[model samples]
Target: MRAFIAAICLFLLCGNAVANSVQDSTTPADAIVKALYDNLSAAYLCRDIVDADKYLKTRSVVEATMLAFTNKQDASETILKKWEDEIQINLKYQNQNISVEECNTLLRARTHQLYVAMDTLFK
Candidate 1:
């Protein structure tokens, strides 16, 4: 939650002009690709999401997408922070008990979903 809030704060701090520019060049496909990349990565210190090698091409796609977003570093940091908060929230809901095993299960499920999404996208 804090990470996501921080990302939003940073984005706002960066100025509206940059945000507008980013939005103008960013497509829905680019956003989808970024979301998949974010979900597949352990952006947060929460847990590891495996099966990344299965979709190696996703990295390239995500890299290209990030470049399209104006500033790559800013976009990467912002998205990572957002994913950190998102993963934490998902872990809570997906595993109310919050067990390590449950976390592993959740991450695996998320990774698999992202992989499938990537396959569909890249194909």
Candidate 2:
């Protein structure tokens, strides 16, 4: 009976450790950007230009600024906010001069930026 209890305890402990390890290994930033990209792409594919434009413009500016700046918490926050504001302004003018292809190009650039940022930050 004692051996059975000990074995059960060991199994639970090992399982918990494994779960925690997996959680720790997951990169939150990468996951966030990837999900954002996927959803944005889906929106564009569905011809939801408004939603796609919003996501792509906001993410593109933020990710680009983040990738360009040195890794610092304060700088990241500041640049991200600035980028967001810029994106909002740009979005207002989107209908006047923007095209689907341009949005796609910006999104691709942002994706590249995200990858570079993750590489630099994680490494």
Candidate 3:
């Protein structure tokens, strides 16, 4: 359990650090960007209640994700806000706390589970 949590936290940190890259929608890197939004949504959902240390940690992750998209730096704030808003809005009906399996499933998408995991783990 500890390792899983640590892995996911590391995943988010890695994802937060890897937002930039290949620009085409058809490219693999696009999936990583989409994955980043999913994470930012999760972080945004928890930021309201998590402790300052955790919040700040997650905030840095979010910031790094933004920095990864080098070309998208123009209007970066708006883009980040829009992505967070769109993804977070979809969570309006979800439970405040998510189970590990559920989160993994929603994020991994069956065949893409490995892809997402590897992307998050080493992006």
Candidate 2: clashing residue pairs, number: 0
The per-residue C-alpha lDDT of model 2 at residue 23 equals 40
* Leading candidate by TM-score: 3
- Candidate 2, 1-123: lDDT as tens digits: 455334433332232211012242234343333433333333333234445556656555544534443344564455445434443454333344556776566556646645664564456
Cα lDDT tens digits, model 1, 5-107, are 4543444334321111235324334334435544434323233333335334444444454454434566765654554455556643232435556556655
What digit string (tens of lDDT, one per residue) describes model 3 on residues 7-26? Answer: 34443334332222245334
Backbone Cα, N, C clashes tallied per candidate: 0, 0, 1
64, model 3: CA deviation in Å?
2.3
| Candidate achieving the largest lDDT | 3
Worst 10 residues of 1 by lDDT: 16-25
Q: lDDT of candidate 1?
A: 0.44
TM-score preference between candidates 1 and 2, better one? 1
Could you report the Cα RMSD, in angstroms, for every candidate shown?
Answer: 10.8, 16.6, 11.3
| Cα distance off (Å), candidate 3, residue 59 | 3.7
**50, model 1: CA deviation in Å?**
13
